[model samples]
Target: MAIRGKTILITGASSGLGRAMALSLSHGDNNLVVTARREGLLRELAAEVEAHGSRCTVAVADAVDPAACQQVIDAGLAAYGRIDVAILNAGGGTPTNMAHTDSAAVLRIMRVNFDTLVNFLCPMIDHMRDVGGTIAWTGSPAGFFGLPRSGPYSAAKAAGRVMLDSARVELAGSPVKLVALYPGFTYTPGLDPNDVPIKALIIQPERAAREMLGAIERGRSHHMFPKRIRVLIALGRLMPEWLRRRFLRVASGG
Candidate 1:
């Protein structure tokens, strides 16, 4: 639970919050199994993790593929004998205008966000159920409600959130701990700053990672960060449906 001297597996370690988390957890005598499609970035992250006084194993694979997910889990088990924690952080989104987007495009976004989580989630749950470990999912506040332009993404995350909720209830008596992390607009390579209406609300990847790690370390069932976003989400839920839609349209620059 402290995250020290434990075998941890992180997906999407090539960049963004995932990479930041790897660096933050690199210290404190942790054993890291970093995986992503990008081999070069994983290697770079591994070197940094080792430099920071932790053991790291690079496992290059796609999070969308269930088999690849299993292999990555096996790689961690092979390297450390057991994985005490698993962070499902592989996900992304692009500006999608649902009105003009095709079914394939919408499905692509769904696979990127939802499928990636499921691919890793299933295998990790099975392995952790017996050994007892923590599984933290990188979710989003966007999932709490449908944002105007990000419908598909919101849907994906909402589905993931509900699934995790169900898993938490089902595994109540099990030793595995399930954590859901919701991060706001984070400044990372994948983000376009101009797309964000309020630049001030955007947080750095390091801060996001820190909060995520803190949630996992504390074994929190769910954590949503940056006070502003949390307040906004709460307000949105309190608003009437029509008013909430209007607010969302204006916020999304529609």
Candidate 2:
């Protein structure tokens, strides 16, 4: 409920929004269990979190691996005996090229954005179902509707969006709170504008992380930020299919 004195487990803590979240929530009352592929960055973050008077544990593993996800959960339980919040924030995607229809690339995108979340979701629900904890996923507005050039990413996040909706229904009376966080155009590492024309809506990782943390604290089932993007998504949903496709083509710089 309140963010203090909670055991918060965050994946993808090596950099970007995940790192920002770890820094933002690292107060004396909190115990941060951070995991990611980058052990070096996790160690650096663990030190900072500890310096802030909170306990920190680093679990270096791939979030897409179910066994690694389990190990991260176990590490938190081993240290604090409970996890009050779990943030599944590991994902990334490349701009789609219609001509380059590589099946492997499509699968990799799905695994990164959607499968990774599922890998962590199963274990988190099982462990927190009875004890009652918050489970948050890093969704995207691309999930709300399919984008023109980022088909794989949009499809993956769309799956996550619906899956979390189902999870909310199933965990209705349980303590586990399911949340889907839709962050639009975040300026985080490995997510550059490059050719994508989303620069106008980009927000820094710190600001996005702070807002996300607040939303989670409030126990919201779904949250989207940077008012402008929400407006765009709303407008996009109202448009005809062909019109929406044209809008996405321009917005995504296709």
Off by over 4 Å in 2: 196-198
Global lDDT scores for all candidate models: 0.92, 0.87
Residue 148 lDDT in candidate 2:
67
**lDDT by residue for model 1 over 165-249, one digit each (tens)?**
9999999999999999999999998788987889999999999998999999889999999999999899999999999999888
Compared with the true structure, the alpha-carbon lDDT of candidate 2 equals 0.87
lDDT of 2 by residue, 69-181 (tens): 89888989999999989999999888776467798988889999987898889988999888889999999998988776678999999999999998899889998998889
Question: TM-score of predicted model 2?
Answer: 0.96
TM-score of structure candidate 1 = 0.98
| 186 Cα displacement, candidate 1 (Å) | 0.9
* Whole-structure CA lDDT of model 1: 0.92
